[model samples]
Target: MSFIESLTLMLALMYIASLSYWSGKKWGAVVTLLLSIGAVAISLYWPLALALLIALPLCLIANKFAPEEFKTEIKINTLREGCQQLLALSLFLVAIQYCINAIQLKQGSTPWLMRPDVVDAFLPIAGGIELKAIVTLNLWDQTHPAAALMLAAVLLTGLLCKRAFCGWACPLGLAGEYLYALRKRFIKAELAPPAWLDWPLRMLKYLLLLALFYIVIGMPSESIPYYLQGNYHKIADLKMALFFVTPGLITLACFALILALAAWRRQGFCRYLCPYGAILGLLSFASPLKIRRNTQHCLIEAKGMKCDKCTRACPANIIVHTKTTVRSDECQACMRCVAACPKSAALGLSLKSGHRVSHKGLLVLLLLALFALPLTAYLAGFWHSQTPDNIRMELIQVIDRVGH
Candidate 1:
């Protein structure tokens, strides 16, 4: 394994170990510690090996000194946020690695750094087209197969676990969390729109989803192969990076608008603008797992008490108390409702068959669904790009002149 890969793995293991220690799970800590040791042993790099040795004891010391309340509350939110941060950091590192390779390729030199295949996740439009080609022509994407595979992985996550990907793994969702936090701090309110306007705004993403599909699905199957092999599609990731790197006035305006909206109303961009989230939301309807209300255990139903903690805690504003099963498309399966319920058994994520999934179980399932396809593809030698470096070098030279 490369140094970056080994370092990322070591850091991820150590992060899990620290979280487990802080969350008071002895077994988790021990197992992760062993894994961290394995990572260090295989790393072979002295600096990382030394850092791991130091980090483990420091984590132990930090855990020992943490307050009792701190330990208790570091359960659900901590696990979810930890996963988000880890995934986001991984993407950021992959972006950096990608930039290094792109820069080298542009300079007419073979890339010294390994180009990360996962960066293809940025090319969802291409993925969508490639997926269509796969379905229609049985042709796998040779150019950026990882893109289609990653899209499939995400769809599987949505199909199996609702919008758990959005809640537990999305980097944008993490950013949205911070934006909403800022809103709470500065604006002192959610500033939610009235239902009359909110309902239509919520439909925006679905409309965007429709528009995206209209383009992808309408393409002639014969055209897909040509399009996928085209110069524009080949270097789509570079173009994507450039958009962010050299944002025009309209791009900046759109970003500012999205940020402002996210701050004004929780997950504003996700709730209304993210076509990916919209697709997931629709696919999530098929998921057997959902946040279900237990009437027998609910305080309002069982004890004649007024309680709406679950509803209030929900970021998506689903009326958790009223629904026997939260069937709203907006529900992200975030478990904030479950976490906030005063009655321990009042609200829980359960299958239609009444089997409950523990928080940890959900996390595991989400991770599996999110990575299984890409991992399988990687193992099968289909994850790496088949495009030649010579071709890539030529494309990067005239990337500014190439367009769809």
Candidate 2:
């Protein structure tokens, strides 16, 4: 099948699965399962099918042995941490494989496996900006299908769950969480910038978004800034891979700085500097699903007192107890506030229609659909680069010469 054809089929299946699940009917699970099987069959991707098969039984077993409701919070947190670690490890392995491929290429040997452009796929801002260039500058043939698909996945997630991807799926956020945990364990305390300082810094990402839009849409293609240019973007991607493959002083220093900032203030980069996250945050304001506070049941209100546990628990520092519905752009739907609330039913995730959402199950399904579609296309030989091998080789040579 052609790449676009495969992608279309995958998207159709995803839409069906998502719709079924969103219906919140008893049979939604069955329909989603069938659609998943159909997706595997359509793509002829046995590996994905096999993984799902294995996972289904394990999930069943886990559900059967699941802890009581009150005890489940700890289990859920553990599961989230485990998933984050697994994702981080998977990225590390991919980096190692890419390095091996590069080494083989340098030694004049044909690498058996080519590295997929997964990093670029995660870059939704870059994809959106490139799409603008395509539409405004008539760069029709330069469509990056993988990146486009990834951006669509992210936006779809935002529509459904309100920045759930940032909370549950972002590797960088997971890393920041880990760093914060470590800092708390070692230092016993962490500091946040004063609200006056933080408020201004938080505006930086929006300004950056405006600047990037100008670069992608206002500037002529030939006059685009150096780092934002195509070849240079590829070089940056290469450098990212090299950070894992062959870490240098710069990479280590940058990593340390990020960790330090994350330790100082949870999700510091995401809160202040991530243009992609800023875009998602804006879209998430329109999401129907959000954390709702039962003010009447809240312990603080009940006692005619003030308790800031939920606020303290929030990584985004949102005043969760004050709002009946958390519609803040900064809310990532992490549910930390919900878990931290001492009063039962004081906090929960719900749709605007008042239907409560099952956080873990729905989030897991969304993430599964997001990754499975692209992976199925990849397995169908329809998701890799359309660029000629000779051109790619030439670009690699140039990157190596520039010592990026």
Candidate 3:
């Protein structure tokens, strides 16, 4: 099969599976299994199969050994967080290795995984800008298929589960959340910025987004033709990768600043500085699913005090107890609020139709599906850049020379 054909089939299967699962159909598992088999058949890849094999038993074990409702939320959230951390750390190490391998590769050989570029590929802003440049400059030969695939995956996640990517997939977010947790446990206090300060700070990302769009799209037509021919953007991507792989003093300082801020306030970067997250937050409003509050069941009013457990647990710091439906663009759908609610069913993820989504297993299944589809396409030799090896080698050489 052609690469586009294989990619289309994989995505179609994923959509079917997601729809089935979200609609509470019993055939969700059947469709998922079919997807697994189809992926292996198309890619001739064993990793997807092996991953599914391992995950199946783990999911079963989690369901079988499930704790009481009160404990279930924490345990599941912890497990999810651990998985995010492990994946992030593993990917970081792999990126470092990719850089080393790039330096050592023979002139004609391409790296198998292209790990250094994966994060860039997944960044919608970067991809969207590149795509626009390609179209505007009529540079069909300079296509970035990997970036396109990543954008598709991200958009799919947004449509299906809102900002689940921020809570469950982003490595930077994992680190931020861990820092926030440490602050909560060790410092035993919340340190939120005042609303007057916080509200304006949140506008920074939107401004950054606008600035980037202007730079990419508002360039003079005469200069754009020349700009596209130059390797400016590719070099910028390499610089970003190099910053993470071998942190200079400035990069280290910036990393420290982010950690310190996260320790002071939960998801500080996500709230204020992530341009990519800003886009997702806006797109999340189109989502049909949301965290709904069952105020009638709430115990806080009975006790003549605010039971702000749900509010306190929200990583986005949204006031969950007051709203019948959480429509905040900042909501990550992390389910911490649902778990933190002492009263059973006080907070639940529900569709607009009022159908409550209560199963932890389904969330796990959705996460697995999100990860599995792109991997299958990648293994099938569909989701990668078509950049010439000579050009890639030259770019690496430039990065190595300038990075030092």
Q: RMSD of candidate 3 to the true fold?
A: 5.6
lDDT of 3 by residue, 1-404 (tens): 22223333343344345435444664875767576676677667454455545555554464456564423444547655765775576566655655654655434466554434354454454466555655666543233445645666676677777787787778878888778888899898778888899889888878887886777577665664454455654454556656677898998998888778878888998888887677778778987778988766877654566678899888787988888899998998888888888877677888988787653543554465465555665665655555555676677666656431
lDDT of 1 by residue, 174-224 (tens): 899898897898679658999999999999999999998999988999898
Question: How far out, in Å, is residue 65 in model 2?
Answer: 6.5
Give lDDT tens digits, candidate 2, residues 1-404. Answer: 22223333333344334334444453765765676677667656554555556545544554456454522343445545655665566566665666766666555566665654565565555566555555656443232446655676777788778877788777888888888888889888658889999999889888987876665566566543333445645444554555566778897887777678788888987887777678888988888888888878887777788787889989898988788898988898878787788875778889777677655554555565466556565655645555544444556666655541
lDDT of 2 at 325: 91
Clashing residue pairs in candidate 2, if any?
none
Winning model by lDDT: 1
Please rank every candidate by TM-score, starting with the best: 1, 2, 3
Work out the TM-score per prediction: 0.85, 0.78, 0.76
In candidate 1, the residue pairs with backbone N, CA or C atoms under 3 Å apart (3 or more residues apart, or in different chains) clash, namely none
lDDT of each: 0.81, 0.65, 0.65
